[model samples]
Target: MKNITCLLASILLAIVVQAQELKLKPRKADALGGTAFAHSISDSTLSLVAREEIIFREIKNGNVPSFLRKFQKIVSKATIDNKDYELVFFVLPDYLAIGHNDDYFYMPMTPILAQKVANLLHCSLPTRKITDLIDQNATLKLTPQPIPPSKAMTTVPVFITHNDLVKQQMQPYLSQHANGALTVGNKKDIVISNKIYGETTPRVVIYGWHQLDGKPIQPLYNKHTNTWADYSHGVRLVQNTMWLNGKKTTLAKILADPLLSQLLSDEGIIEKSYYPVFDNY
Candidate 1:
């Protein structure tokens, strides 16, 4: 009876742990953002960054294995510290799991996996207390703490802003999340595109983000200024605006194009966002 009870408790704990899902937000290739821990930099971040460099080197070395060869387009170069750099680091495993409602990929935080990642990248481990960032994030302010001397390994989330593939994954949730509705904060006008509504015409749906008391975020539009501002720039939306091909196109226009629309509406992409990502069974 004692053994059985212990087993049952263990199973229950596993179930609870498995129930936690990691969600990533949508980010475009050109989207700009940073993810530095308040305390000291974590080992996972260094490992991830170093691994990225290795991946770049592999492609450059021209001895990339067959499996990696197939990913030539993605494994092209390493420009992390460069300007034309388009990818933004979103999540670093030490405190949180930053992902999107769409099909965002996650890197597991197992001891062996984490250690191997560090070894392969030749980076030092992030000190302890890195996981304590949750305390600071609760206040939604920057107050990073350094990791102390400890042997415990931690998993945290890092958001990497890069590529349309990631943005598509983040779309359904960012634009129309069911549980947590998107609330626009302060701003003059909110310009929505057909991309969010699955339409075409370069049409701009302008809306206001500011509200008094309990009033809802209202929509605003004007024909005079081609600029459809919303949520006072960064304060409103959590991520950077999608600048498709460096051209600031409207939402309606993107929807109008059959090619763009089809890419956005791919069944494989949509299903991943709708269903549980890690549920392979």
Candidate 2:
């Protein structure tokens, strides 16, 4: 009696374990994002209960070779809306079977997915070289070599100005980002430097130009001069401007320049501050 009771318990445990194995089924049209009905199967018995439209004969007959079968549960083909589609299943292993819902089996990964599943199954997956993997009709193109770094810069120049105070304030900022050497000289003196310039044209930043007492200069028509005087020059203390690439430009314009944009980005400037203005240009 004791031996018989032990045998019965073992059988019951086996039945419980088998029942725990995952079974995936088709999701209805409403849930499939209007694509098509889908289903998954790991056993031949699935054919008996699966819908008639889900073609299962290929999987049930073991048409797919063992090597391919080790990765994914066999693939079954179906026709919906006159379009052909493939259905694949996920099989839970015997050791730790778990229940899964329909969505879990909807879309499986491509080539690499099979390899991952094979690894989980503790099976040896065959490897194919790139030459073997490429189809006869497919062509592989090599990437073109990049332009030499030496030719990245196009022009170089030395800045000579009378505003020593403003120059002193901007020197550190310019020196840090200058791909070429930063040369400063008096209005009458010439400073020469042997520094390689990058592809971008460099600029000089001038402050408090076309205005008296270093005040913020606005673009206004001077009636006496009868010309657009202050409009071309001046940087305000609160509303500052800079000479970008040798042109007197506003901060908005400086951020728009592509090379300056990259430079500002490299200097740890946040993108959101300038991205909106840059997008328009």
- Against the unseen true structure, what C-alpha lDDT does each candidate score? 0.26, 0.22
- Residues 1-281, candidate 2: write the lDDT tens digits: 97898687657544543332212232223332101222233233533223221322222222221212211122224343565533222221110111112111111111122222233333211111101111111121111111222321110100011122333443454433122121111111000011111214221112111122212222111121111111112111001122332223333332344544332222222222210001101
List TM-score per model, in order: 0.18, 0.15
- Candidate 1, residue 270: lDDT: 23
Q: RMSD in Å for candidate 1, one decimal?
A: 22.3
Best by TM-score: 1
Q: For model 1, what is the error of residue 189's alpha carbon versus the real structure, in angstroms, after optimal superposition?
A: 5.3
- Model 2: runs farther than 4 Å from truth? 23-29, 33-111, 115-281
- lDDT value for candidate 2? 0.22
